[model samples]
Target: MSLKQESPDESLKSQIYTFCRQIANSRPIISVCLCDGSMRAFFGGTKALLEFLLIIKGFKPRLMNYVRFFDDRPAIFYAVDRWVFEKDVDVGFLGEAFAVHLIFPYTPLVNAGYLRAKEVKLKKRLILELLENLVLTFPELSREIRIKPEYFVYESMLNRARLFPPMYNTLSHFFQNEVCEQNFNRVMEGYLIALKELEKEGLVECENGFYKISKSFIENFKSRKTLFTNLFRSAQKALFMSLLGAFPKVLGVLSERADILLKFQFFEKG
Candidate 1:
């Protein structure tokens, strides 16, 4: 049973169970992703972002009623959980999905003239998660996947274009310390290779300096998440991890779009 878009609660729970059952019967777990889009679909709006998050985090559900993001992109948050993957998480349905949500190799923000802010990280994690899923599902690419660690660095930097303008320095200052000239250039080279690999797999369409993920990738990602595993964790849990570390708004998707539930956003649209 292939998975479809966010559906009614009945369809969501049924499909989720089916996917989980399959993973349980398979080999080592591969990938686990979270999306902001799925969160909106499940909870219905960003108004509940904080409320639902609190509930999931053992907070008083009613007390969280005041939290809200109210951004764009269906304000949906979604993600999937995989046990062990060989390489990438190319759910095809990359952005707006949780799989590509938490992993921001660099700062993530969507500003004027820069639509794709998290492209680099998105590509890297998407491929890694997808490869992981495929490896667990197909058992091939296991060795090849490991050989291309550079693939992630390259893919994660491709979307840096969205770093300027309205977002300006606000975004760069956050990640500037993490990336220097040497390391940044290395990541750029990796981005090129990763883009090449993605194009070969029909995941994205690329021009001279710009790139875009194919709709098929999005659809496949949704299907894999729907038909394969259950989403137990969320961006909220991952980011706002008070027990572990401080959770800052490094990834703008969570801030720009409020409907996203982070990790727990993959429930059939309720």
Candidate 2:
């Protein structure tokens, strides 16, 4: 029997998937390594690794410096402790290591360069706001609001760039942020998870295969004097910087509004 050659992204995904499955099976795995040039980091614990993989799956990291898997062993720990504390606790056989090396095509739409913990949370909050506004503004059909998950993800990343160009640009690290057909399923699934989160927050309701804004959410939104209160609270600096940078005219307008500065606590000493 022979195995077929897999692309760099696929190879990386397979290795991580195997490592995750091993962890699930109670293997003695310590961590998964993500390497880029001279920089590298370990993603430990099941939940964190899974989330990391989710980002990789959607982004399709183009130039993988290579992924290395390491398993736990008493000998490695003993050597480390002896070097640091001048004492040893245990010594056993060495652990196993697996490495996958590959280089992907140039000009990949998404890559590991954009994958950051802070950016992930930022993107999530922005997407939630986008969906909320969509449901609220889009005309209802037959007196029932319905939003397709697939369409939302598609438009949010590409078609709707004009509506939130700064946000989409910031969410994407590269110059190109278009969604490829291959990665759309995972991306859509990721957004579906976001939709579920909105539903859990009582902001949206799901019924008959679509989503609509919850009545309470509508009432609250109507009562509010500003629409971005929650959005600003969740992402204060990033959103402000992006918006201000995109539109310098906004700065001139904002500078004249002393009340706005005080309201946002920009005048308060930190």
Candidate 3:
């Protein structure tokens, strides 16, 4: 069944319940994935499942609470056995429902700037946790996803922007770094050009003077690939050129490091 933003009706709940029970009885690993902003069943080997579990290690109890108690909140809930997933404990939802909660922000914090200082501080903490989970889950699967370097830069800008104090006076701070600080105008010019390119591509948009990532970007991120796969080869090339032209030295060093890492992986396999 296709998952959507609609509230869970009684029939949908029953189907999910049955599906969970059947899978728990037979499968050794059960995972739920958010796809196109909806929850659906996901299957993976033991290692992938374990890696995903590590990313979400601490959020299980809260997620189980969300599942056990029905709320008017528009969410899809699924139940799976903790014993089946973890092998030792007969406890919670085995991190099933939490994936939905953690991955998708129910409401995008677009006006984060308007929030009070204390409120912004609290939001930053939560955003950081979400960011950590997201980073941990993706690196191992990045190869399979074929995430291009330019998209990585685009995603980094959005994430880094989220970490900044929303009240900061200028968006240029989003591009600030040791490299940018040293070659300020050059790096800033390149990043701004790249940012505008990303905006043109619709992966990000300017909202309240902040860059708000698109739902399509989030979906691609959730899947660990597949955002602009068939669509943006030319745009991706343009983005790479923008970065390469702006930071040739830095990109050169990065390329060398990547080559070394790739060689090491090959050595291990060989």
Per-residue lDDT of candidate 2, residues 1-270 (tens digit): 111222334554565556434332432222232321111112222211111221122112211111122231000000011111111001101100001000101111124343222223333454555555654465243125666766665554452234334434323422233433333443444456666777888877888778776777666655655456534432543443344233322322343344442242211121
lDDT of 2: 0.34
Q: Determine the C-alpha RMSD for candidate 3 after optimal superposition of all C-alphas.
A: 22.2
Q: What do the candidate models score in CA lDDT, each in turn?
A: 0.34, 0.34, 0.31
lDDT tens digits by residue: candidate 1, 29-133: 222222222333443433322211110111221111122223332222111222111111233231222222333322111131121323453455445454444
Please give the clash total of every predicted structure, in order. 59, 0, 0
Against the correct fold, how does model 3 do in TM-score? 0.21
Question: lDDT for model 3, on a 0 to 1 scale?
Answer: 0.31
Q: What's model 3's lDDT at 17?
A: 47
Which regions in candidate 3 have their CA more than 4 angstroms from the true location? 1-182, 225-270
Highest TM-score scorer: 2
lDDT of 1: 0.34
lDDT of 3 by residue, 138-184 (tens): 64542234322233334533443333322121234223463233333
Cα displacement (Å) at residue 198, model 3: 0.8
**Which residue runs does candidate 2 get wrong by more than 4 Å?**
1-124, 135-143, 163-179, 227-270
Ranking by TM-score: 2, 1, 3
